[model samples]
Target: MQGSSIAVDKIATELWAAEVIPRVKDAVVYLDDHMAEALHWNRGLAWLLDSGALAVRELSYFESGLSKAEEKAVFIVGEPLVGPCLSRIAAVVRASCFTCCTVITSCPPAAHHSALYGAVPQQELRDSFLHVEEQLLDWMGNMNFSTTVIYAPLALVSVAPNFVIMPQFQDVFPTLPAPQNTNDSCNKELGALPRHLQTSIQSLVGNLCSIMNMLNVKPDVFSLGQTSHFIGEELERCSRSSRKERGLTLVLVDRTMDMAGALTSACDSVMDRVVRVLPPFTKGHSIDVQVDMSSLCAASRSTAESGISNSVAPGCLSHRDSEIAMHHLVTAKQKECLMELNRLLVEWGSRNGLRLDVGGRLTPQLLQKRVNQFRGTSRNVLQGGLLQQVLGVARALSHPGAAKLQDQYGAEKLLLQNAVANGGSPVVQLLRSRHSMGLSLEDVIVLLTLLYSLVGEKALGDDECLLKAEIVQAVYQAAEKDELPLFLHDLLRENVHEENAVLAAVDHMFDVLPGLGSTADTPKHRLLLECSNSGTQPAVYKPLTQQLLHEILQDDPTLQLVHHAGGLTDRIKSGFGFFRAAAKPHPRDNPVIMLFIVGGVTASEAKLAFDVVSSNKINKQVIVGGTALAKPQEQLRLLFQRQFR
Candidate 1:
């Protein structure tokens, strides 16, 4: 799998350098705090403006910076939100003494205008737009500075937006990309959009096309999964050369295509460990992490093989030393420094005829002496100082409480896997028993939803139905206790009902269709199963879309099958001429396969696409991208908010 972090960072950096930076002088870059964290915007902007020219500040500081500056350029980079701070900043920018100002926003023109004016009627929206434009023009009438507004839409389809600020469930639907030839009204949301939420999605599509054009690679085949017709259509419209070349394949799918994967919490992976331990770590970027020294020390001591005394002086290292230690520990390059420090510590202990322990501490003066000696030579001093800090944090994360939570997650995963693989009364019985897995109500709901997706309503027996009802009631009650919106319970119930209906319809079609029923026993079906879940714990727990891409690319199968859950299957089949015949058998020719998830994709999914190609397989390449990378909790919260709020 490819590391999307690098790709996104590179893209953002390239875009900024090529487009945003050169146009301005003495610019103050105002970054959305959340976007800064999500896209590592600060790092990208800094790298692009290498001459220490970029004054990177939080969006909150825009007004303050405006107040302090005169005849300087101000660049506001963020989503359009009409909060008091943003309104004040907008007003101030119009009146500021900035010579050359630029507003590079992620939001599309329509969404930006809506945020400024608030949602209003069509006539009112125009009036508001004119009013804001007039206000800005009047304010800047006498100013010498030139102002530029750039809508740098981030049409991020393969990856979810911010997990912290999740979209509502209504916003999760696939959005039809606005036609390039369409008028400005195409961007506006004057009435309830008959298709999908165009606000964020339109910008997302536009940005995606921009990125694709920038890269100069045209795809050969575009296989869109169910409900992803809109994105596929947009890609087709934008990338004419890709369609003509017909060498690269692009697959677009929705989140609901693999709902089970999205809802299930991952276990036993580096990514999972990071997600579990580092709550504040957003999008794999290191932030200012708050460490509880006492708790960490206690946890470390308890887990240590030979318990070392905690008699070390509290102020052994100065506050500066502590901060430096933390920086060394968290920074990526310091891994080598840490290793060298470990080797040196072992050597020192051996030379001094002193026993070295994991929890052992040395006096401040001794540690400082060692650090000072290695200050110019090696990073050992800093590493040694931070050893406790790192070890303590790791140990604390491995505490019994965390272990129990993992155990619960594991149990839930096991049950779901078994339910999918071996569907019978036993799984239903287990589901019915509240204490069988010792899982929480939410976990049960997730498992139940997965089961519903796997086994159709017609296939489910009375016992399973009863168990489903019981679980639903339990989840509803639990939500009430937690003060969560009651609609969340209803949403889950609705999801189960929808899944049942869809699966039942699929089953019916298979039964009625002549060749489809028999095809289930073929190797193609087996391949789909392998891609979805390789019948292994790691595969099952990992992102399904990623695992599928990995297997398809690694095995280099002559015939590749792409499965989607929505109505776009026919559209994809029709668009891709190779799969035109509905009853045709798998082709023996080695063909590139594409898989896409529509609603959102996890980080794991994005990684697999990059990883698969890096293997340098001949004619074996997989392209994976998604709308977003949303967490289970975030998705659930969005669903709740969509239904209730």
Candidate 2:
């Protein structure tokens, strides 16, 4: 279940609906204001374009020759329109089918993307941006039609009610600033951002400040991870209003600092498992996956009316429908999805005059069994077409293949937790026999990255650290001896370079996994290695995000009052004190706790925010925002500098 407050995603979509879309309509109306017979608005809703006499006559001027065509406005959303996107825009602009066209974007124009992150944008990047712009401009100028492009201050996409992402920068990692020089800095280096990234961070800070200002809420800021100091500098530049008694706390963390959280698979999460198992159907910046819904539609009994046609044709799910369905699926837990699906099937069966009973209660397993038994009869076709793929998914979860996959993930997590100090043999065997272990090169790379993040480069000299070194050496050997995947070799060549260079880059690969953990007793192998050989307590392993949430509870000054209240009698006495004192109101009666990851946040990590909020801890809303909702493969690709497909 979700929290009482609006989810981050709903807020974002509503922002577009209430702000961006309305502005586009206003612009259209403003342009038509001077016309003698302008297009009329229907019920003050700009989304519906009404073609007047003048608008219809205007269509004849074009070579399209649609004298009776009704004028419509086509609004496009997406940033930095690429070559194929530009061509599509050109076609729409040239067509007489639509009277007006507008492109609404949140990001900097395509030409500026490279410059925002790099000292100098590559020649290819500049040329590509220019080529796209030139083609669009050529088409617009030749047509002589009125087309407008509006740049909005909208970069955040709320993927769910409480989760936000900037899809454009999904692959971007904040550049590490030059380390501050100091006598004792050999062991611990301070990180800084590049000049371009400084500008980008400042811009982000400015936007955040503006939002805070608009909301009339002063914020207490906490910065952590690799880009902490850089973000702090940007925040310092912005003037803040006086702090209030009750105000929200903003936690900004760099995702790279939590390599373990980003890499680990969440077995209990249905959305996590689906994203992991299913190959994502990527189209430009959108990440989606296909799912069969033939029997699902029949069970819901709304097939024809829904108009969800795909390449599979009638009784099949469409691409757009699949995206919407998956979005809903990811927002809920695995058990919830199965329960709901089973209920729908049972209800539909009763309504359709088919008396279906799986022990008088339809469960996912029993339904799956029945579906298999009824695989190809006329009755099966009439009753529910084909078996619902989701049911098959439920069944597959208990299969040996899924069990083996879970075991592999568990082993990887355990090995990473101990920094391979608990016998690196298992890791070596996994890397050497990856094909049998159901591990890909990317998966092995993730384990290595996590291992490196935990132990870091400094520990390679220690005898215990030699175990991890051997594991790394094994990976290198595996790559050389075995046949590589189509792109794995290229990825290794471009990013890894030589074995020693890669060993050096290990520190840069992932920011040292923060020493923070669920408990002090847990052996945090990384921290102990920093000093010249001192006995430091190991950190108890837990999700970095959960640890962060607990730290927030302990650190927030406002929360301290509620958490440290003496007793019920003391509180009542204070409430009835001579000052006519009432209990201090929690800022906004439970202000939003926004945890924004600087680089990218993973779906598994996002679940932690929901957990904190759902538990009613501190009675506050916890919202997670990031550059992207990263998958393990995406994380690997980002570190290795490969084009994510």
Candidate 3:
């Protein structure tokens, strides 16, 4: 935490700027052309408003700079523009007096409804698109305003560096039919992955290949899901080429595979911890949390040279800025976050002509005393920087009870240790005294999952199973009574009244953990899982993606693809291999691994992918994507849907 810097290599940064951002820009470029400005979606709207091509009588609270335009030529750029969004836009436009409006959306009709895209046949999907379009046209035709709708398909949204998500396919898991003959109690069998899901992942892999300019190399696919073999097959089908080298390692994981990791607290990640304490403002694919940027804004105003008093807003941080900060903050370790914040504050104070070197450690009282020394921008020279934004983020992360959450995390760790020592009897004790322990029911559930994972169901007797049932029933009651967290409350509640499903999901994590070499007694694994009290994140809590990549690299550091035995003609006839070549072995320099989670991936997992690629152990890179980027609670709820019903 106190080194030159905590080094992290992010290949997604280059991949996004070079490949993903261009696709996004191209999708919305027509809006720029229409407005005759080289600005993005929101910026283009702002420019049009300034130039009189568009107008908004009322300021929109949700959107930054400008809301959906109520007047002429309102271009809405978003993935999967569904009925609700369209209806809202239509309502707003009808309320206005505009004669004509052009509604340019970033998704087509079929793609607008994600379930329609992922669950139906191609012909049916196309027909549904037509039907939706016809209905939309009719709705607009009857309205007061004449509207022209434009559909521009944008299948992927780059949420963070090296992390992309399909906003339309958030519930990819629930849309697919559960395997037949599987019990409602718990079904963890490998079923045929849905074709639409396969095709979607295939398309994504192709995009990555095309963007990276990979040659005739087949991908080394490692599928880690009950139904992810189809995804690997699809990728392998598309990646058949004449190139002799295995270009990349593509890992397809089902989110259901590791329910324990998803359900647990990501104490290492600052964003995960902060989001748990403070609710984020979620709009479309963007998530923004509250922050106190008042001081930062004040500093900005003091340093503005344009003579405009309102150069910066003084309240909440903007969505764009907040997300950007989140990306960096989420990736940083907790101590790293604190260290960086301290550095930024010291730098800001120095620029503002305040001597704030109080024995090299920044304290709350001393920091406040130094802030009081700033009087009317006396000797303030340098322009305001990211200090305010970072300050806001820091304040939000360290909000009231945030420290207590960390303490609670430690307590949970101790509970797990106690359970491990006493053969998971501590969980039963906690169940009896959960309120006295001050543990949330969610945490209790997570503890049960970890206990089951460490000590198998065989070790957990009838009493433990009943304890699980009691916990699940309590959770159901809390959810019914509207006492559960908002994320849990909104989970797709099917016939998920079975305790066996929860235990099955936890056992599934154990089944996969051994394959990833995490169960082995290697020094690295030992050090990783060892206890730590040095104010650093515990090493045991790695993102599953990172662990999978590590195991893959450990076995074959180069990550070469295993070639098919069939010749080129046979492969072509089978239609599973794309490019089978007889060229010399192509040397892979700094290979890339693409990890795609079928259901959804958490921010912590995505951040860990970045860290693994950036690590010096293996010279490689990773890009992680999923059907949707979700929180731990959201993932747990989704897990319940897949496992039970």
Candidate 4:
């Protein structure tokens, strides 16, 4: 060990804590190649793995591949999936894009994330390598993971290097001239200092690390509260049976390992707004309308990504309306953020690359709190909490694209109908190319994968993953069996409700009709009525008739449901929601609100709103509407926004 050359310092400070997973070889079925509605990101793992690009073990612990059953059962409507693993995968890929070592001799994050797409990062142009601690904590989520994940930054302290060093008692070694050296170059200085002097040198480096920790890393994680502990606890429980006591073989490599992955593409604030509740699986006729419950709320910018518009089907109208405005907000916010990032990148992108700096306190009285947490508590924990909330919105957007925007812009195209065509980023603008993509949203798909596969199945694989996955599937599958019964399919295909039989059956949002078969819209309407009846049912978090607005109205507390057609939440319920900014000079300037109620709304009314939600007197007119007030299923889209854009 003495004669061995060591390069521990830098590696320990930089490598991603995740295991290097083998990239599954995939013959990509481009998201655009297929109708966006026909796709499910959960099946992506199967496609990638089946193609043989990625080997399970070789992938980063965070970079997981999906299983067969998980993929097969995902389409079961009421059993929608949801979790942290997917978010962590997202975080890992994002964090790896920045590289520090231009040389590929050793694996590091910048290099690793770059490797995902087969790209080489010359140097992770740093904007300030802040939040290293937060990212590490995210990778540490509970719910079963063997290997208490290690990082290259930590490994760098121990990994052997090409340079050689001499025995401490005899003589000191000299610094070798390396092409990528950022440290001060020392020319062969071999002075034999006393043991005390050597100890002092060690202390100086150690102290530097301590200072860095104080400045950049977070303090104890307990500050994040019980949920953090809950995740860790879940991980431990899930990992027990999976841990093979036998020593495992592995090597440290980060996303930069896949320079090919990032080549393609890829928050929350103002919490306490949205709310939705449901039975575990898609069970009975019971959806609780929380008279008043505080839930998380954040807006999504509408430039792109979200699949909301008039082209949507009646069933999906509510889904589209509920999301458009919020996503529109996120787009605006991120664009501003992008500008700031671009400005900073010009300055800091070269050194270490910028990390989204958050958390940490500045002075005395401000102790026990981070500046941004608002409450002044730990920011890392809240960030994780935000990830959980974002997961909800993502689960809400994945669609089959049945209501895709058509090529028709007749005398009455809805004002919000062509929303997806709008661009939020230079990259997205190029990707969208066309005006609108009538497809299921990416956010909901990713969310479902995480919820159902990773967290729901507790997919750490360190324990009895086989058993746990089977159990999860069994519970949800039983629900699916009940809903998609053969008789139900026969009824659906018989054109019982709409002109198109299959569409007619789909319109019947319920599994079993509540006595109103040919007369009622079918099971879909029955299911809508069941929303009020979904007691302590396991299907609550599961999929809904329309994955769109059901989750929002049911899950989001801020979601207001009024009997009337038009008005703002603030104007109606003082301080009701966030829209009370300032009065507009003119009524036309009022924001158009797009609201949606799930299966509760009648199919005819849904079709009407789907047709009208996007129409305008002229280009860029704002119209706000969701489920019809007269519709039996009552979660109508209220005038949440003062006026639509």
lDDT of candidates 1 onward, in order: 0.42, 0.47, 0.47, 0.22
lDDT of 4 by residue, 239-325 (tens): 223323221110111111111111111111101011121111111212111110011112232233332222321111112112322
In model 4, the runs with Cα more than 4 Å from the true position are: 1-581, 584-593, 599-606, 613-645
Distance from true location, Cα of 463 in model 1, Å:
5.7
Q: Give the local distance difference test score of model 2.
A: 0.47
**Model 3, residue 433: what's the lDDT?**
69
Estimate the overall C-alpha local distance difference test score of candidate 4: 0.22
* TM-score of each model, paired residue for residue: 0.59, 0.61, 0.64, 0.17
Using lDDT as the measure, name the better of candidate 1 and candidate 3.
Answer: 3
Runs off by more than 4 Å, candidate 1: 1-9, 23-25, 38-57, 60-73, 78-99, 107-135, 139-145, 153-196, 241-248, 266-268, 282-405, 417-438, 458-596, 606-624, 638-645
Angstrom error of the Cα, residue 577, model 2: value is 31
Once superposed on the true structure, which residue ranges of model 3 sit more than 4 Å away at CA?
1-71, 75-160, 163-222, 227-249, 282-286, 294-328, 348-360, 363-385, 418-422, 453-465, 472-482, 485-543, 555-590, 614-617, 626-630, 642-645
- Among the numbered candidates, top TM-score falls to 3
Q: Write the per-residue lDDT of candidate 2 for residues 1-645, one digit (tens) a residue.
A: 133343444443344455444534322221211010111101122232332222212111222324324343433333345334444455555554444555554433322453334332322232334444445446645455455564443455544456666654554464332333423232232122344344355445544554555345655566565454445444433424345444555677766566666666654455556545543332233333333344444344224432233533232111211233334345556667666555555554565554555564444466565544433445544334223334434544544545555866776655554453432334455566777767666566666655555555422323534545654565466567664333345445655437765465343333322221211113322212233222243233466566667556545443321221223554576766734555543323346777777777776677765776566456667777776666766676564542111
lDDT assessment of candidate 3: 0.47
* Model 1 lDDT per residue over 1-645, tens place: 222212332354466556655654556665554345433322344443564444666555335344545455544444554455356556656545554556666654545554544442132123323343444445565434455566554323211111111111224543222234445354233233432243444444445556655544444333333235545554544454343322334555556445555555543222223333434322322222222233222224223332223432221111222343332232212234244444455565454454455333443223333323322323343334354444333433443434655665676556545545555434455545645556555554454444343343322444644654554555445555663333354444444335454344323322222211122223332312423554554223334455445555555454344422223555566567555446432211124444556565544444444545566454543444444444555544443333231
Report the lDDT tens digits of candidate 3 across residue range 400-506: 55665666667656655554444445666666666676666666655655444443342243484566556566666655655564334444244234456534544
